[model samples]
Target: MADEIKIQEIVEFLLKHGDGYDADEAREAAKQSIEEGQPVVETMCLQMLAEHVLARIHDPSWIISRANEPDCEDSELLKRLLDSGASAADLALFARMSQREYLSNLGCILDGAGLYDTPSLPHEEFRIFAVNDEDQPTAMIDELHESLGFSGLETEMELSRQAERDSDNAGS
Candidate 1:
């Protein structure tokens, strides 16, 4: 309910600013939104801002264009996939990349979904962390990498795995 109101306020602000406002104004507005407990709204505003400002860059044609120019490894790889006719995996990854701004605009869904304040577990409950799906850690990591381009996921996975290992060691 509160989130919905925040979103409405953001929409109103955007409508007022329109697309003609200066970048600084947009940035300041976004900062204010986040500071006011509306991080999700702020993220949505930033995503819209990117689309408005960067629409001309890396045009949608990149999906069909070949790479002939020097660029970052990721961009070059993306181009190669496009030129070679993107595989299902590649296409999924590409879609994820494209929708990243929007998903991030919704705030950190993964973090928000985690059981941050769950009650204590029973004594018999051994400390074995499992992901939502039945996938092993590596598979989950890969899916997350494709779904969200956060470099920190791998680091977080490592830490989680280490913690599990430490717990098992302590139990033994």
Candidate 2:
């Protein structure tokens, strides 16, 4: 199929780049992975290629700059979630965080799988949201303070809540 040929081509190109792999070895590995029905070999080939690419990232700015592109925006699903479920106070907590805190928060969020050895993902239709397993939002927020060093976030969330309560009472 076209996909198989494309993958073999990528493997050949990466191996030819002298990452301790020769063109002949790439051909043999690619053949086994494609013609011999050993798909896992292709996975190894791609992982080897990824390692070489990741090792070349000498500057964090390269990643930061690319992340600013519109392609990196939260998908339409998340935009809707914020519109419907998220509150002004929630947005305030995020908007007020320092740059360091923002990146730290993103790192913590991205690596959140650390707590689970094997996490069950939802169906594609529900993939935009975390699979809710009967957890309250407040409890999960509290847990993040301990798990991700988000004590400052926890405090900010509290202040936001109190201010909202004050405004509500004043409006009455």
Candidate 3:
């Protein structure tokens, strides 16, 4: 039996550090793919191992469409907080302790109500991986492939990244 956690780790490694990498996204894709139970997701992992490991080239198709989901629910008080003169810090604290129950492990909520664009992480920096298979590419893939192996299969790394919500602030 393949260790599902290990597969998630491999999926994350390829997306975060592999050829056409996005340092920010790999984690979420790791969780989603496992829960999603989609073959395309697995195929994506295979593709990443097969190609990016060998050739550091990017396929335009690799730029996939993803939903721009808010990491957490904005505080019911978010508007009030903003209205009352909460510093970004106040907002962050409120969000951390309260609002972000869903993706609490991912991080606290930093953007909400689309009032302004938050393009970066502030003050604290955090990076986490449920597993660290990043050190050895061939070894990691070899181990996973032999057990849950699929050879000669073309696939894409079913990775995902959360981008800021509409800058135009549409649908506010």
Candidate 4:
């Protein structure tokens, strides 16, 4: 019963994506889905395509997309905070709030608003994640950190040097 539904969904997705519904591929996916006991809706067609079709797509965009997706479990709360006009500090504070009701309700509202951009984090706290399953590729949260002006000591020194040079030029 479910296998049929899985086949239908897979076929529909493939068709929508212009795959033209090949029997061989559909059969294989269906077989794998049944063997894995995964719902038809859970078939990993997109993963296969990422591995095969758009293999050239860079790690950063892929990681950023995953980080931005509201449906993802790991960053779902952070995503909600961004949507709610909450800064990174707000998110961290919310995470500490004792009341679950307030947090959950606000999360739903933020999720419904469709805002999925990342929130600001400190420069020293900037995080990097391996966007994909493999650990070799990494994407950093530089923009959010830089936008917050959380520069490191080295960066501050460089800026100081540039400022001194500009002052000398102005005096001359």
- The number of the candidate with the highest lDDT is 1
lDDT of 4 by residue, 1-172 (tens): 8867767766666556534657677667667766776655433443454345333332234434544876655455445656777655444444344234433443343223322343544432232443345433356435643564536546756898998998899999
Clashing pairs in 3: 44-156, 44-157
Backbone clash total, candidate 4: 0
User: Lowest-scoring 10 consecutive residues by lDDT in candidate 3?
Assistant: 60-69
Model 1, span 1-172: residue lDDT tens = 6745565566566656556545566556655665665554545566687566445433545433434445433456557676677653556455556666645543344333423334565623322334345432322223544655555535757888998998899999
Cα-based TM-score, every candidate: 0.30, 0.24, 0.21, 0.23
Question: Sorted by lDDT, highest first, which candidate order results?
Answer: 1, 4, 2, 3
- Total clashing pairs for each candidate: 0, 0, 2, 0
Across 1-172, the per-residue lDDT of candidate 3 in tens digits comes to: 3646655675666575556756445555555655665444555555555444334223212111111223323333344555677654544454344423423322233112222234554433322222235521232223433654433212211211112244235556
- Which candidate, 1 or 4, has the higher lDDT? 1
What residue runs in model 1 are displaced by over 4 Å at the alpha carbon? 1-44, 50-58, 62-66, 87-98, 109-172
- Show model 3 residue runs off by greater than 4 Å: 1-4, 16-24, 39-41, 45-172
Count backbone clashes in candidate 3: 2
The per-model lDDT (C-alpha) reads 0.53, 0.51, 0.41, 0.52
Query: The CA-based lDDT of model 3 is what?
Result: 0.41
Model 2, stretches more than 4 Å misplaced? 1-11, 38-172
